[model samples]
Target: MSWFEYRNQVLCAESVSLAHIAKEVGTPLYCYSTAALKANYEEFVDAFRDRDVLIAYSVKANANQAVIATLSACGAGADVVSGGELQRALAVGVPGSRIVFSGVGKTSEEMSAGVAAQVHQFNLESKTQLESLSEIASKQKVEARVAFRVNPDVDAMTHEKIATGRRTDKFGVPIGEARSLYELARSLPGIEVVGVDLHIGSQLTDLEPFKKAFSRLAELVNALREDGHDIRHIDLGGGLGVRYRDEQPPTVSSYAELVDETLGSLGCQLILEPGRALVADAGILLSRVIETKQSSERVFVIIDAAMNDFLRPALYDAWHPIDPVSEPQPDANRDIVDVVGQVCESGDV
Candidate 1:
């Protein structure tokens, strides 16, 4: 189910040989498959066709202009966390009405820019930030549609660095304190409480955590409705995992079913922010082997790509399969050598 495959005796990305691309573009380059990107976006659209949903591709995943534009052409909106990202999405022809501004730290200038652009919604994280947005929106004489990203305290069971829904995580307002904050937002000027947002974490493989978090979200939405707030949309920030190693991530159809089972009765628009799931497999960092070093006890295959070029392995000990552009014979000899980068650091492997 991947666009990158080995054809004959060479590796290819949707029929274009990786070896040819490296020969032309040089080493340490990123190659993305346009076909794969469109396919991934279309899969999400097809899965949610029956429901009122907005698939906002998270810009932070892969901010390449070509990647964003390709998704935009496939009817994908954007979930941006900064003013620059918002501009990128807009420059790529994503309408302001289709962009959701989200971040914990929003400067006055960023808020002003978002307000001026008439963004679809602002996923506010803190009361002070919410107050700042209200003041800015009031000054601009426009009501800013807002949603409180609530921390459901449900563990996403993902990596510690990526988890954002836990009680200790500094991503969103605590769920217990959300109702009171909603009450305050109701009284604030130039603010419209249109929805609730929940983002647990990134690279989530299982559905139990999502189910628990979404069930909590459902309760909060009902309570907010009883409090006279028109909860029109639910922004379930994306954290769906993909096959990175042995991880068998849930299918998009199954994820859609989970959403329907949890919040289908609410009759609100659903917003999903999927970043890694859509683009991770569609692109590859094509690096050439610089040299091979043999020590007394071990061997190292140094690559032209460094940690600065691809930091996930160094940052999170993430694993990515490496293969030569020229296919080795089925009975070729194998070596237990460490694949390293020329970063001149001990942790460069």
Candidate 2:
């Protein structure tokens, strides 16, 4: 069933009405539909039902325990960047072996937590990070499974701030340097070289970047095998986008086909870390108008919400279709009003 719809001249979430939620839970509330989240998650997993894949929900998109726990219930793992996220995953019953830790700057304490939890693999971002993780894991007397995240030097063609695979971005190692890193990891006492990882960027609508990055990764995988490293898993870091407004992102099934066609011959497990694609549409921010004012050149509708309640609009100038909780009458007055938050910032709209 559609999680959000209109019934009896009112907006509803699942079986409950948004107006009812406003009266009880109050406005300026964030609501998520369990059915919607589970359906999207299951759809992604079903797309890879034929492959050895682990769909790890990216927690950075929405870290609510209920959200994580819902995905966890659907057998979803977690792709976390911080120790707190690891803890959150664990708390929600996402085991350590199912978690993949990825980030550019990982504190020693954070590394220790991961080493303690024994996460699935650490997506090695830099040599310095690898060195620190190796030392920490050796002290803990455990072999840390690692996948060297490589920059394929492909443009994701998404927002510049979100694009990660470019050469100038502070992300994974250059594609040309993966072999040397694999050799170096073999020499380390605490690291086990297991797989190759590459994520172009987030909110990517084009499949070309994924194809290019995966093709490069396929070539590198064969090279690594020739170098005698047991490349078991190919962590195709996830950036499959979601429909925030009117985006036409590639389907998860199509992405799976691309992976199978490009690198499936390597006989390696595939891992995807989807964040926004899974959760963004599953949730909604509820607010109410406080007042309506008109100036000489403009009209404004002040809402009870603040920019902090929903930062995407201010952060990325994002667009989300807004509608009245109660359907506006056909004969209702109409005006072009700039709906804004209560913040003092000029951009808090």
Candidate 3:
């Protein structure tokens, strides 16, 4: 509410009232603050001003055209995970050199598109993918600048669904296996090993996991250099959480300090792909209270928005604060009720 505040008893995004938006664009709407997105992007950029850094906005969080264009205009790159996102980044004037194609499963067509685009980096997750990209890059007459999404196996202690860098998870190569893969990549005709990458998890409130993972990455970088790999960049895949509720995640400045301490000595360009930290707070879903039903077990306050519109609540047990556009009266009746969407699923809370 501090950012999207109640001005004169009405919720406003910056200075524009939400009620006016609903009247113009209809309800069950998604609203975002350009100012918030710009500020968040700038804050992260300012933190790493002392070093060579690329702040690639993770498009998975919010693929809204305006959001992508806003960041792109500000000289921010993109970290896209799919072909559609890659095209979106391009349509918004993001050069392929500024986009990093990530994700565990990328189709051959996607790899070909990435090759055609000559993206900044491909975060390869498996041997099969390595061969696939090599074939495509060679056929397309392009050297794919790539990085091994190294699994440090450090538990980020966040939600299991979003955690990527673990021994058990089907993500990046294990730290033990990365060096050999780098050698294999060296032998490949069209694969250029340019960087190391790792993403432990999302919604991380602790910095210890980052310190552990980055420390391991630094060690791996030294080993890679000793082995004559021209490692020029490090993609410390971003999962710095935002305060959807009361979680106190690390600030950009503190995280920058850890980056400087760990990878600064390696002299590699730094890349970060922040998702929720950039977009979650900058936008909100606006819905209407449809009806209220009372049962012996519970009171259900049904809303017009469904699980399909915003799935994080049911999908991740995520909590996003819902507030009335108009402030409640001091004497308004206080009731304990289950606020829910109109989805048919029982877990659509």
Candidate 4:
């Protein structure tokens, strides 16, 4: 079921009458629906049901333990970036093998900790990083399963800050250089190139970009295969968009269909790293009208929640629809509110 249906409102995060959650849990409280989370998770899983897939919930989006525990209960592994996220995933019963670590700068200490944890793979970004991981793995006496995060050089057509796979982005290895990077990994004694990873961007609304990214990656995969590399998985790093507004992005089923049509015959395991779509709508930031004031230019509905509570708006100048639970509703009274939080910063979301 859609999160809208589950929440019984246009919003999916399930704010319990606004007043109730604000009064009980306190204003600025974050509320998530277990049902919405599970349903969204299941939808993604079901999309790739016909293929060998492992959906790893990205921990950076919302690292709440209660939410992670719920996803863990539904057989969701974790895709973590930092050491703290790895610890959080482990704390919530997600096993080591189920976790995949990805980041640009991984410290030796952090690498040592993840190596000790024995995660499934580290989505290595740069050659220097790969070497560092190699040295660390050698010291620890372990074979590190590493995947080259490839920059497909495709435009995800999303915001600049969130875009990762573009040619100019400091995200992954350039698509043309994957073979050389793979050779480098092969030559490294402590590291094994087990898979390929690509993350174009976040808040992507169309499938064409993904298809293009995957198509480019497929050629590289086949090239590696012909070169006698035992590539086991294709980690199509997730950027599945969610409805923060009325528009619809591709459904999980459609994405799965695209994957099936594109690379179903490759026999490599499919791994998805979805963070926002699965949890963003499943969770809602609850705040109250702490005070209302009118200035000469405009009116303000000041609330306790701030950019700190949910940083998306402040970070991206993103839009989130707000409503009042109390009655005396009027269409004329509503307008674009510079709804702000308690942060002392002048630019608060």
Clashing pairs for predicted structure model 4, backbone only: none
Model 4 stretches astray by more than 4 angstroms = 1-18, 327-337
Candidate 2, residues 161-188, lDDT tens digits: the string is: 8999999988999999889988989999
Clashes of each: 0, 0, 0, 0
Instruction: Give the per-residue lDDT digits (tens) of candidate 1, residues 38-69.
Output: 99999899889999998999999999999999
Candidate 1 vs 4: which has more TM-score: 1
lDDT of 4 by residue, 16-78 (tens): 455555567677687778988988898887777767788999888889999999999999999
Local distance difference test, per candidate?
0.94, 0.90, 0.91, 0.85
TM-score of each: 0.98, 0.98, 0.98, 0.93
Clashing pairs in 3: none
Q: Please tell me which predicted candidate would have the highest lDDT against the true structure.
A: 1
- Clash total of candidate 1: 0
| Cα deviation of 190, candidate 4, in Å | 2.0
lDDT of the structure predicted as candidate 2: 0.90
Candidate 4 vs. true structure, TM-score: 0.93
